[model samples]
Target: MTAFEATFEHEARPISRPLRIALLGYRSDPFVGGQGIYLKFLSKALVELGHQVDVLSGPPYPDLDPRVGLIRIPSLDLFACDSHVKALRWRHLRSYSDTFEWCSMLTGGFSEPYTFSRRVAKYLRSSAKPYDLVHDNQSLGYGLLTLQRRGIPVVTTIHHPIHRDRQLALDAAPNWKFRLLVRRWHSFLRMQEKVVSQLTNVVTVSEQSRQDISGAFGICQSRIDLIHNGIDTQTFTPNSEVAVDPWQLITTASADQPLKGLRFLLQALAQLRPDFPQLKLLVVGKLQPSGTTARLIDKLELASAVRFVSGISTEALVEHYNRSAIAISPSLYEGFGLPAGEAMACGCAVISSDGGALPEVVGDAGMLVPAGDSGQLANGIATLLRDPELRKELGLRGRARVVERFSWQRAAIQFSNYYYRVIANADG
Candidate 1:
């Protein structure tokens, strides 16, 4: 018999008992993107709420809380090495899964999720300890169906939809060839769409994301749950010692991706520079060498005025937030705008685009501009630059807003309840 059908005492516990949760991620590195950040904090929060949380991730493993277990699910990790060809080993050929990954990356295809799922399925079959449920961190891999068949109740959080990013990148591609390459890179959306529809319990960060996921994956709205992501106010709070730089604007974005709207921010900065020569930008992300963003920065003639900082610690990020006069979220879409919320938590004035769930998070605490509008973004920056009193007031209001509505503690409680709901249904 399965664990779910074991002796009554072993199979079912008191409703108050702390759950055993396995959080799955195909690839998670906290500094890489928002998904990694989600895994890091949610695992930490779940553990703090007295649940046993194990994060299963493939290489570039996440920096997780010490108490939360990290089960390193190894992959080819081709992206980490100097060259994909050089990264290949004889052991890789021994496994068809690894061979597929090597071959996929060789041809500009992403095969991590597919191979990672096979690894996860194998591990679950042999794992001595069983879990009450598996909470997926947007992997949406076929392993989830395997888990369900093996009696592991599964729920997943679809953080917006990859299809949205794929479309935005395709639209921004300079030529049909580049668009075809983009299409090939994002072909996993087909699997995600199929998997999302089959899963019974789906959670998303915002109502905006829920609608987008439903539309993008053609899934029913009733299957998705809304869980507002939280900001760590204690760690991201205002540092009075770090004086705000008057002319420096800050934003966190994925440098080359069209969905981030970083290109538009660069355009807005170029527009503002002549009027405000001292104006500088602190970009909290990598500026890939020889990439579109790098070329655009040179074209805009703002090389000296813009600086990129990546892979900084949370403390360092909080310091950056405190040091800026205004923080901006220029994402074309975000399931939940963590950077804007972090800025607000740091007592910094914010100007965010009404993209995805940003307006929902900013909520009268910050200025809102239309997404992809460089002129409006520039004007919003200028307004904050001219008005110190307004900035101070907004900063105060933003901090208060974070304190009132957002916290990991609250999110953990909600998630624990959600977990029990899924578990209870499975048991019944």
Candidate 2:
């Protein structure tokens, strides 16, 4: 049985009454990454379930549903600014959080999670209103302890142990200097580890993530709740009108990120060029000019065969998926594999790496190759390319699986049940 199916067997009883919930996100913009997408969809789904949801988020705010309220918790947002050193002001000195954020960014450390949590904790303490629960999206900072001490119920979702990303980046760094910078940037993991270990309730997106979180944070596997993320079938459905391009393959990844495994995909693309010269890749991410992926593209001479686009709307992204013959996810590791699930929802034949929780998401619906293996990825792509009927069959199956097993409504129901249990235990 699938993880979702197993979870359903021991499902907690759902709360009869609507909950007043607060979802916390440090940086919640859909374009920023999956955390934002998680907040956006999860809030929308919870609202549909008749819950009054308020998203308390830091800068780069999420695009949320009209039913859900947004409580802005402003931060330095130094990364958005062109020059972090110049962005600080005398006014910043008034607030320790702001000062710390500014100084941390200047020194190549990410302090958003810690600072955002501080701001959020202060907001909650001062506000007259009380929430039934506060659900935090991976911002596992020390401030959560303050909430716990105040008799507030809090559940944290750690998408995956970010130590995986840190390790992958350190491995990919060209020199000791670069590796040192990577370590500095991910220094927040120390705080996260401490926070997670002390928190009463913690959750993750997949079983793979649960295992990884347990190992990375030294937490017990049984303590972590597993909730599979959902795909928006209504928005990402198959477009029958759009003609699929036979030569087009699409993938969504941060082009320069070592964990995204764009390099392996590019190498696979290079290997298939001689057999299928017309094959081209469409990347749904920004291209960093000086990044390793850019250099690899030049080295492999696949620039002409590859294209990158970013800052696209959901409608545009769905259209791109429809236009493509196949979607590929070559990530070295993924917590939940949103790209692969989105592709499946769009009825696109998918080829994904067996990275982290990708197999849990893709299952038998799509082709799976070992992560970071160019030869296997190329072979999988070539097989799909040569067999149109197989691609069509996989596309239909993928769509069916998503519609059946993955939906925001189902996820919200599961969340509500989990919330009910957390609150009951706290009260008891």
Worst 10 residues of 2 by lDDT: 1-10
Summarize candidate 1's per-residue lDDT along 1-428 as a digit string, tens digits.
21222222232232376999999898899887878888888888888878999999998999988999999999989888899987889977899888988988988888888888888989999999799999988888888888887878898888889888999989999999999999999987788877877887888888789889888988777667877788888898998999789998999988998998998899999999999999999999998999999999999998999999998999999999899999989889988899999999999999999999999999999999999999999999999999999999999999999988888776777778778878888888
Provide the overall lDDT of each model, using Cα atoms, as 2-decimal numbers: 0.88, 0.93
What lDDT is reached at residue 63 by model 2? Answer: 95
Model 1 lowest lDDT segment of ten:
1-10
Give me the displacement of residue 363 in model 1, in angstroms: 0.8
For candidate 2, write residues 1-428 as lDDT tens digits: 33434657764345488999999999999999999999999999999989999999999999999999999999988888998899999999999999999889888999999999999999999999889999999999888888988999999999999999999999989899999999999999999988998999988899899899999999888888888899999999999999999999999999888999999999999999999999999999999999888899999999899999999999999999999999999999999999999999999999999999999999999999999999999999999999999999999999999998889888898899888878998999
**Candidate 1, residue 390: CA error in Å?**
0.8
Model 2 TM-score on a 0 to 1 scale: 0.97
lDDT of 2: 0.93
Clashing residue pairs in candidate 1 (N, C-alpha, C atoms within 3 angstroms): none
